[model samples]
Target chain A: MKFSELKKAVAIIGIALFVVVLSGCSGGDQDQEPGEGDQAVEEGLESAAGGETCASCHTDKKKLVADLDADPPQEVEKSEESEGEG
Target chain B: MEAEDKVLVAKEFLNTVHGQQGCTSCHGGVEPAASRKEAHQGMVAEPSAQKDSKCATCHADAAGTFEMTLHKTSRGIVDLDTGVLAARINPEKADLLQKAVDNHCASCHIDQCGDCHVSRPQWSGGGLIQGHVFQETPNPILNCTACHGSRVQKEMLGQGPSDFEPKLKPSVHWVPAGMQCVECHTKEWIHGPSTEAAVRYEVKEAPRCEDCHVDDTFYDNAYHKQHAEADPGKTLLQCQVCHSQPYNNCYGCHVGKDDKGLAYFKTDKSEFDFKIGRNPLKSQDRPYDYVVVRHVPVARDTFAFYGEDLLSNFDASPTWKYATPHNIVKVAPQAESCGSCHGNEAIFLLEENVAEDEREANREVIVPKPPPKF
Candidate 1:
């Protein structure tokens, strides 16, 4: 084969390799995002750590003590202004 | 002349003897004795000592029978040191016997015994000649025939011990075989310690059929159904009758219009029906034991009349009230109302379902491809 043809063949092979590597890398990245999306979906379905998280701040003992110390309101005070107005 | 003179002298001497001592008063024997004096001595001796034979002569029959009776034997044993004849006296019999002997011994010896002895008239109060008078206070004088005859005492008293022996009668009611009296009659007998037994044996306070039965599981089901049914005669409506299907998933409302061309509004009164599920504790698998739900409609407002619409409007915005754990009161929008069925967990996820997916999409979609701004 001629030397110039040999150069053209090597360039063609290099271009093919770059395209294959790019596609493979892109596919893996695309697959990872969907998995992350699935994880987020599952997490969203689960109840917010609302009650569970509050427990971390207010342990059983702390909650009991707070309950003991807290005075019950004598009557529900009428709102001077509606809180929900804002 | 000599004969006449002797006869006169003898007459004179006899007259003088009669005058001196009243004829044979001082003399002991008169005639039939070895001599005249011996006969007078027998006549003068104090009447020979009266023996017990005198009393026995009259009391022959009674003495004979009394000697044979257990009372006589007991008397002998009690007074063994006393003479044999003395042993005949039974203290228990003595009072009665002495009275009889004193009053009627002579009568008994004679044929007159039967007059008083045979079915004697019932005596009243105490009296002398009421021979062998039995004071029948509370107890009567019992004869041998009183207890001995085959049916004698039974007529006075009752049937024999065999009558008391328990015999099972054929049951009029259908009782399960081998069911003991104690099963239902728990306190019938004294079965335990004395105090416990006393408490148990009080028949008046003992449990009746209704005591364990009124609210028992077997009968209570029917009892409750009797009151609950709309038409009791038509249906033997039990809890299980209407609740044949176990769990129900409730839906808020219908989005589409019905044939009548009126929009349907879901109300707070809407409920899903449920039946008693299998007991969870009995299940082998824990996960499957969770309460299952199958959607069913309990109530629906089908008629779309103007009156119904007004009622719905009133229900939607009546004076607001606080919600209780047991009763929720609200007419939130349809989406918000889903919480009534799905609960808070699913309600929270509605927003997250769209939001979280959209955040990850990484490109915004504008309605159409926009030209780049100069």
Candidate 2:
């Protein structure tokens, strides 16, 4: 290969490597932003859930409706009788 | 008869005698009247324009002073239109001076002449004797002992020093100055409403020991300081210390063990040892032995710990996620968690008092382990 062409190819490769490293560093910065999912998980661990996890899901009307109507009476009755007057 | 009617009689008698003769003519009999009746008759027969003679018929000793007092010297007493006595005798005429004496003096004395005069030797005699007239005896001569008798007077006056005696004098300490019975006593009805009188005058409210000794707002800082300075180590000095009865001075509570484990609770110390069962659901079946616990030297950081079994059942774990060098139990709760038992402030103080070394020793004592199967 010609020496000039080899030097140009090597320069392109180095530029590409630098871009990858820069992106990797910025990726952690992106997670630090508020409203992100990872930040929410950190807050959840600090508060120890304390029933708030269940409350968050149960408070959603759609989810609550889905949970209530998902099972028919036959299935529910069977579970209740098996528990036996608990 | 109404006092007004009697005063009218007195006025008429005065007018009659004044129209005919001088004051000395009728009052001359005062010298010979050894009895009250004689003196009263002499006064009634010849009324005096000289107000002193009018009073002197009975209150002879008081007459000289009364003549000199503001009541007699001032025109306010005799001037029918403007005099206080005249108004009292005839209130419709706007004479306040007359009304004051008539309503105040005549109501009690009854006989107007007797209100002023004295005839009996025991009553008439004083230091103020002059020819045919008695002047006012000095206060020293007219002391309570004279009329009430020395023994009764001394008892009533209290075993106090005489007014003339110096307070700092060695002999005077035995007698306190002005400790007279009259200090608290008055001629007014003192025992309470007398059954004899249909309308009873309410007795005056007497001063309590606190009245003069304490200032207004005595509960405030200034007065309290004064009181403390005056009385060292005396109970009354630190009134608030006893009165406040501070409740924040102590800490105590209880803990209960259930099938799951143990939980702490704040409880009344008086009923500390009463067994409360492990499960709130089965409180009726009291199981574990009741232990009464109390924290000494109440501080801000006291705490109680729940057993592992109890924690597992309740799912209530302590706040500290990571174990410290002093805490052997993996999930040992912070002292603040026991606030239900030790109280918030007390728990804080207790935690503060626990030195690092002590905490380390305590941590060594507790070992985290799996529950042993029974």
Candidate 3:
């Protein structure tokens, strides 16, 4: 092939590679539509106290501690055989 | 959950095998999720909840056998074959009992891998225990004692829930030796190689008093010579019979939904008791003719709140079951003198002492009479 033709082929290959890289970076899962899980996530967010996101409050130590401490887990086995025993 | 701790967890996790794979691998949230809602979509809160979860993909040895393990199955509460539930309830009402279990006892059962290794048990107020890091051996106090505190913690460490009045004292080994659960309960036993165990004591690999006190000279003690070493036809006593302190005994646990529809369990109040009874689990492994027993929280109407006559065959098993209390000492109160226990009729579970409703049920375990003071 002629020098000019070789140069044109290389340019085409470079452009194709660039387009593929660009599409790969930004186009992942974008074509899929939101489903019920996404809807539930939205609903769950609406119900979250103060509309906090996973990161917004979880990352803040004081907020996380306060939220957890407010309704913390059971620390020890409640061994009372009945409803009201010490 | 400080911001720094969160960063540290992520940072440390990234360096580990699970962390190397990244969060989206097992957790199932969107990788490049732009918003909290997007990230939350398809996210699984406990990916290891299933018997064959991604955790099983790597820890196959443990995860596979875990299904049969005491900690995972809580067999005492729910197993069909060779379980306290099975021994009590009739076959026809098994399903109903299961529903009762789900509503009331399920919290006590291990539902996921993280329940033991990464987080505090859900029954003991569920949350991250050690920041979601997979620990080979969980912190005994935070994870094991959190659920077992009523008995094991109190007996072994001599402390229990704040409500445990008349606070107990530490066992001979737990405080002075500083021995952790794994020190005796080996990893093989904890993770499990699988066995047909109806109760924790049935696990063959479980720690034994003889395992540590193997010194032959130790048996020179008259009590040990007479009891620990087998003498045919004689009433061989378990070590706990002489060593264990009065441990918590709960009776008549009734479980059902409350008027407000929340699940609740009630009992006849617990007591610190130490009673020697005929061995309910008399097998080659446990040859003792007499052993320590504790009054479990079960009655004919224990599950009546769930359904009428749910446990129709409750009389099949004794309410006073075999126990290995942790409160052991070199010289226990009962061992102060032979007379302290030999003629101590109160320490022996007798017919007159049993509740009228439980007399027939406890016939096998109820001592006809205490041994004559020799």
RMSD of each: 61.2, 50.1, 13.3
Off by over 4 Å in 2: A1-86, B1-143, B156-374
Q: Using TM-score, give the best candidate's number.
A: 3
- Angstrom error of the Cα, residue B184, model 1: value is 51
lDDT of 1 by residue, B74-147 (tens): 22212222312122233444444333223312111111121122212111111111222222221211332222
Clash count, predicted structure 2 = 35
lDDT tens per residue, model 3, B1-374: 33234322322333345544546577787544444557668988677786588888878988888777787777766676666677778778878888887777656777778877777766666566545567878788887888878788878888645565444568877878777788888878877944666777778788887888859697788777877888785668888998887898887787767555677777778878779999988988798989998998877887887678888887888889889898888777778898989888878898887899998888889998789888
TM-score of 3: 0.77
Report per-candidate TM-score of chain A alone.
0.41, 0.37, 0.40
Docking class of 3: incorrect
lDDT of 2 by residue, B1-374 (tens): 21111122211222232312333365443323333334335354324334555445544554443333322233332334433222112233234323333322232211222222221122223221111132222122243334433223332233223442211121111134434333433222222223232211111332222434457655575434543344545322222211111111122322333344322233332111111111111122211111111222211111122212211211121111111010012111221132322222321222333334233322322212311222
Looking at candidate 1, what is the lDDT of residue B153?
Answer: 26
Candidate 3 TM-score restricted to chain A: 0.40
How much does each candidate deviate at the interface, measured as C-alpha RMSD after superposition?
A: 75.2, 50.0, 11.6
After aligning candidate 1 to the native by TM-score, how far in Å is the CA of B31 from where it should be? 41
